[model samples]
Target: MNASAAARHPYLSPDAPRVLAHRGLVTPDAAALGVAENSFAAVAEAHAAGVAYVESDCHLTADGAVVLFHDDDLRRVADDPRAIADVRVHELEEIMSERGGLITLAQALDAFPDVRFNLDVKAAAAAESVGRLVAPHAERVLVTSFSDARRREALAAARSAGAVRRPATSPGIDTAKRLVAARALRRTTRVRALLADLDALQLPERRGPIRVVTRGLVRDAHAAGVEVHVWTVNAEDDMERLLDLGVDGLVTDRADVALAVVNRRGTTAV
Candidate 1:
C-alpha cells in the first residue's frame, strides 16, 4: 500500500496509483456520447468501468438542495441562460433529464456507498451545506476549491458538523501560489508549514505556460509527506509520463484510458 503519504486521508486508494474520473468521464465526444459532466449517468459509467475515485463539483440550487453540478448556470448542459442558483432542484432535474439525470448531494452519497468522492465546492453558498452533508462520510470524501476562504469555510463547517477526522483537502489557488514560491525558494520550513494540513497537491500540469508540476515540487511535497496529483490529464502518453514522473493521482476526463495506462504501467518505481 503506497498509503504512507496520505495515511491520515484513507480515501485515496492504496492498492494502485489513484485515477479520479474528473466530472465523471465526459469524453472528447461528450455531446455524441451523451455524457453530461457531473451527472449521475456519468458517475454510474465511471463505476461501471471499475474506477473508484470520482471528482465532482457542488452548487446550491434555489430550493436549497445541494447538487452535483459544475457550472454556475445551465448554459452548456441545458442551453438555458438561467443561473443554477435561480432554479429549483427539481427544475434542474427536469432540465438535465434528457442529457443525464441530476443527482442531489444526499442522493449521490446514499447511492454510491463504496465510492470515494473528490468534491470541489464551486459555489460559496454551497460550502457549508457541502461540509455538513459529507461530515459523516469524512473518511471517504475530499473537499476542495479554488478560493482558500471558501475551501476553509467548507472544512470549518464540516468540523462544526461533528466530523472527527478532517476531510482530505488540497490547497486553494492563493495557497497553491504560496506553495510554489516556497518550493522555488527551497524554503523547507515554509513549504512544510504550507503543507501541514494538506493531503495532496491537486494541480494542473501547467498554469498557462508556466509548468506547475516539477520534479522539485513533487520531491519537496513527498519529503513533507504529501502526495501530488495532476488534474484533467487526458492523453495516453501524458498519463504514462505523469505517472512515471511520480504523481500519486490523475484527475482525468478520460478515466477509461487512464485506468488502462495505470494497469499497463503496473506500479512502477516511485
Candidate 2:
C-alpha cells in the first residue's frame, strides 16, 4: 500500500497485520544490534528494510530530554546503573554506546520522516513530551503505555494542543480485567464495553490460567471493535499458533523471521 493508504489502516484492521520492526529490526549479530534497544541506527536499519512502523521505548532524563531507550535502569545499555530519570541528558550522552552515540527520540523521528512509529512511553511525565515531539506526525504515530493513566494524560495533552488526531488507545489488560470485574457486578452489562474503548488490548501471552490470545479472546475482541496484539513472541511455533488464532499483530525481537513466516504462508496458498 502507498504511505497514505497504509497510514489510514489501524495496526490490527484484519486486512494485514503490518510488520512493525520491534526495536527497529536489528539482530544480535549486527555490529550495532545489541548496543542499545532503541537507537537511531536501529530505526534507520528498519526504515531501510522498508518496514512502515517501528516501535521504541521513551524515557525522560532529569533535565527533561526525551530519549529512545527501553530500560529505566542504565545497566542494560550503559556502563552505569543509574536510573534514567536521575541523570541529565548531557551526562547520559557522554556515556556512549559501543558504537559511540546516544539517540534522542527527536533524532529518530527526524531520520525517518515518513515511517510510522509506535511510541511506548515508560514514564508518566514523558507522555506529554512524547506527544509534543510526535504531534507533527500524529497520523503516523500511536502512543501507548502499560499505564492507562499515562495514555489518558497523553491523549488529553495532544487534544488540548489541537493535535488533528487523538493518540490511539492501548489500555493494559490488568486494568481492563478490573473494569470488567467491576461491571460484572451490574446485571447484564457487557465486558465488551471496556474492550471497545481501547484501540488494542495488550496482555501477557498467558495471564493466570487463561491464554490471552486464545481463539475465544480474539473473537471477543474483534466483536467488540478491539484488536489483539501479543507481545515478545519469540518461538516459531508460538508465532504460528498466534497467527492461527487470528491475532491482529505479533510483537517480536525477530521481525525478519516473523515476516518470512508470514510471506512463506502467503506464497504456499498462492
| Lowest-sum lDDT 10-residue window in model 1 | 1-10
Candidate 1: Cα lDDT at 239: 88
List, residue by residue over 65-146, the lDDT tens digit for candidate 1: 9999999998988789999899998788887887778988898889998889999999999999999999999989999999
Model number with the top lDDT: 1
RMSD value for candidate 2: 4.2
RMSD of 1: 2.2
Model 1 regions lying over 4 Å from their true place: 1-6, 27-30, 268-270
Q: How big is the positional error of residue 23 in model 2, measured in Å on the Cα after superposition?
A: 2.2
Off by more than 4 A, model 2: 1-14, 31-34, 179-189, 267-270
Superposition error at 118 for model 1 (Å):
0.4
The C-alpha TM-scores of every prediction are 0.94, 0.85
Alpha-carbon lDDT, every model:
0.86, 0.69
**CA error at residue 88 for candidate 2, angstroms:** 2.7
lDDT digits (tens) for residues 1-270 of candidate 2 = 112333333433335665667777777666444455576667776676656668788899999989877888788676678998998877777775554367788887787777777878888779888878776666667778888788777777777777777766677546666644544464224565666567666555776775545676666667666666778776779878877878766677777777777676682110
